[model samples]
Target: MTGPRLSTRLRFGAAALLVAVGAAASVAAAPDLPARMVTTWDAAGEPTGTLSKTAGMWLVPGLAAGLLGLFALLPRIDPLRENVAAFRVHYDRFVVVLTAFLVALHLSVLAVNLGYAVDVTTLAVAGGAALFYYLGTLLPHVEPNWFVGIRTPWTLSDDAVWDRTHALGGRLFKLSALIAVVGLFVGEYAVYFLVGPALATAAVTAAYSYVLYARRGDDGSDPDAAGRTAK
Candidate 1:
């Protein structure tokens, strides 16, 4: 909604480019990296563990590629493919966000291995915050689909429940993202800002969906409730 609507091909291409750039960067930096790359870090940005250089270099790119493939396939195969189509723009935006986040992490790791003094934990927290903010933006616009949005038995069974829950979820998610931003200034407690509120938002949204479903007084067995038409 903020800019020109992008074609699925373009959005996916953007995500692919991010993965490719990270892969290329890894390759370019290969000779300079140590035998083992420090891959894990504590909240204070202290290195916690390492991965064999090759494995560390490729792992995130591989995961990003795999996720890109999965995101492409899921929309096509979902039972409510039409619903996914209705919100394809936002969904694609989310895919790009997720891809960018992973690639950023990959490049950040690459930078660290190249002896750059990068604070990876801060980068992760910032990336996670951005991801959640995008998710908040996407949720309210999402249509009922098997693969995305806040899926629960209640939300799946009724479009009203799905809409209501997602609306609430959108706000909670945005709030959590803001809370995560606040953590950036708090020192070692930074990660807790991202984790705590995100987890709470998820739990709250699922429960809200359940309670709303029950309050509607349906046992949720009716096929028509799922927006399906019998052939």
Candidate 2:
């Protein structure tokens, strides 16, 4: 387990532990903590709405644990189990990054609840950029698993489709992350930078994969299938 599984377990375990510890600390600080805590921040850097302390403390850890468990089980349940094994390293790293992001988010909320001076928007933009960048890095190495990457039927059925689609997707995702970072400097409209790019990437990649698949015809004689699509 030292090579891959050990690291995987450690990544997931650490994330859950970190968040759980934070939650426990929060409760310790105020055992009678209100059912809801105001965690939201506005452009003026003020709290907006009250979030359930009980919810904020445990929500992310629970979600992280559930998702990690699913990631661990995918290989055993997927019909393309061998294909997943081909890029297990990339897959594992993706899971680790995701867990880290969740922890970051949980901490941000915890800090706000603890009355720390925090720029919630800045934290969100930075965290989003990092997560998107990692997603871009992961897209190309994905091997059509049921749980990750572009999972259109075309990508799943044809390695060529999957390769080409993810290649394009990786670029778009990286570009989206850059746009999100730039948006951090913008005013109230900064959210568009994050939302717009993500939507465009999803739409374009799904359409591109479908087109490529269709181009392959019923017999799968597309140029990509013949290994002529350039590496």
lDDT of each: 0.91, 0.78
The ten-residue window of minimal lDDT in model 1 covers 222-231
Please write out the lDDT profile of model 2 over residues 45-102, one tens digit for every residue. Answer: 5667776767767777778778878888888899878878888877777777777777
Q: Which pairs clash in the backbone of model 2? A: 37-51
What residue runs in model 2 are displaced by over 4 Å at the alpha carbon?
Answer: 28-35, 39-48, 224-231
lDDT per residue (tens digit) for residues 42-134 in model 1? 777788999999999999999999999999899879988988888899999899999999999999999999999998998899999999999
Residue 49 accuracy (lDDT) in model 1: 97
Candidate 1 residue 151 C-alpha distance from true site, Å: 0.8
lDDT of 1 at 27: 93
TM-score of 1: 0.91
